[model samples]
Target: MKKLTTALSLVAVMAISTQAATLEERVKALEEQNTVLTEEVLASQSAGFTLVDSEKTFNGMGPAASKVYFSDNPLSIGGYGEMFYANPDNGDDFADVYRFITYFGYKFNDWVVLNAEIEFEHGANADKGGEVVVEFLYLDFLLSNEFSLRAGHVLVPMGLINLRHEPTLFNTVQRPEIERQLIPSTWHENGVLAYGRFDDLGIEYTAGIVNALNVNNSKTTTPKTGWIRSGRLGSSKNASFEPAFVGRVDYTGVNGLIMGASAYYGEGSNLKNDDANDVDGLTTAMFDIHARYENGPLAAYGLYTQTTLDGAEKLSSNAAEKASGYYGNISYDLGGLLGVEYKMPVFAQYENYNPVEKTVDGQNEDAFETETVTIGFNFFPTKQTVIKVDYEMNDVNSQETNTLSVGLGFIF
Candidate 1:
């Protein structure tokens, strides 16, 4: 009886040892699986899907457009969209998808990156006068903190809106007429640029050569609209390619303040299919002085711009010899005053411009003068989205008109 009991005890010990070995193996397998899952989670977090920081911008670009500069992954995607409805006293009431833009960026390495913007306007339907276009596409060679190079289709660094054209960046539903008609806010061309910043000096500068404008593009230049805006060649397939010089400098020495000037000089008569004799020597020059200030809840920004046509008589009988304009905007954040989380800013803007300030035929400039007053408010539902409402009072050549506009804008 003693022997049988001992044998039973040994068997019981052997069974317990086997159970312990199996448990150890299972725990080791689980640890290996956990390690793999943890690695995957970390990778997903850094996969170019990070949130945007509105206050952060790189190389004077908008936050969304600068995503690649701050991205951890090799590929980045960002964009913005805006839609608006307008009711005009002397025109038709309409609602339209004004702009939808997408930014695609890829990092070839630590020093080289590719960035591009594709824009869809007015719903992108040809029958409805909508179209798709590439606003800018460039390769950035980041050489140092104070100097870099960019080549390909690039935005002409001229005014506030031209560099930062996102809807949320502006206070009005429509861009100021001065920026539109005088500086041409969305101006871009194929070129090579050199840009840099001096942190110690608090200065930023950009200088480059871009495709010259074709003053002869009749589709853009008209008697009522002026030839300044028509000079942008953009990225058309058959666009003429004459080199033009452009330069800009800005001072940010003081916190919450930016002051700058930009200039462009080019021969505008460089048409691809035009006769040399008919083109003549049409030289174009443009310049602007701009400033922006933000302190706590109060913000103000404005610019004064002028353009000159040296050989206006050669273009047409009614060609404008010179154009000039100015605009100012100020806003106070009610959200900050009320101590709320979201933002609500009320703004007022005033503009005076004359696209036809001087005509080759010596026409009266008073008949082309325009003035506008706009009052508006923007409500931010989130950091990346906003709702806007505004009323505009316009006087064009002493003819008065009024309009009410509502808009929705978002960025990501």
Candidate 2:
């Protein structure tokens, strides 16, 4: 009986030992799996594309253009696109893929970065008034919070829309006409720029020397017709490279408010090579004051700009010596009032501009005078996408023309 009892006790001990071993093996396997899953989650987060932060901007650039500054990976890719349909009172109605732009960026290190923008306009079909072009390519050397350097093809930081031209940033179906005619929002040039910010003072500054505009190389009409708008020599192969000085300053001391001024001074003549025009010492000066404010459901923005040509009279009998314009826009979001998840903003805008506000020969000064009134609304299904509708009334030299437009825009 004693031997049998001892044998039973030994058997019970062996069973317990076996159970302990099994539990140890299972725990070890589970630990290994947990480690592997943690690694995969980390790798996936750091790889592929980073989602855009719509409210974030760096160095006064649009949100997508500023993606590189906040990327975790070395390579960052982002872009924006827009399409619209227009029906005019006296013109054929048409739909156009207005612009598609892509931004590519590489982080060489913490302090050095490279960024480029490639653009396709009008569907990129060369035969149908479409073309692909490089809008900007630049390298930034981030030295400190107070100062940094940017070199290469850079956007001219002269006006509000010139630096922030993304479709979602504005409220209208089209860009402000004043910005397009007087400020030339998409202006870019090859140059070096120095920029800095003072956080305590809420002041930001940019000063640079860029390729000057050659009045002799007007692509649209003669220099006399649209001198100010036509003088933008953006990344053109035949563009002359004369040095121009540009400076800008903004005050952001108040929350959700930005007010600033900018100026450009340059010689507009292409005397470096033998051009057909007999103009010399043609100096161009431009200046603008701009402001924008947003608080909860309300938003407003506007600008006043002027340009002067010193030697425009020598270029042509009808050349414009002065150009000036002003515009204002205000919008209120109904989403907040209605307690909806999506955003809906209704807006109104007014503009008065004359590309030929003053002529050298003092004739037909009012020929290009225009007054525009636009009423629009935008529906944002998502933070990165918007659908827009607007009606525009344009009075050109007292002739009224009206148009209706619908559009969609997106960024990523």
Model 2, range 96-115, lDDT digits (tens) per residue? 99999999999999999999
- In model 1, what is the error at residue 320, expressed in angstroms? 0.8
TM-score per model over all chains? 0.87, 0.87
lDDT of each: 0.88, 0.88
Lowest summed lDDT across 10 adjacent residues in model 1 is found at 217-226
Per-residue lDDT of candidate 1, residues 1-412 (tens digit)? 9999999999999999999899999999999999867655755885736456678788788888998898767788899999999999999999999999999999999999999999999999989999999999999999998899999999999989988888888889998988888888788899999999999999999999998876665622345665667777898997778899999999999999999999999987877765754476778898999999999889999999988888777767767778888999999999978889888999999999998788778776677799999999999998889999999999999999999999999888
After superposition, the stretches of candidate 2 with alpha carbons farther than 4 Å from their true spots are 1-47, 217-225, 275-278
| Per-prediction backbone clash count | 0, 0
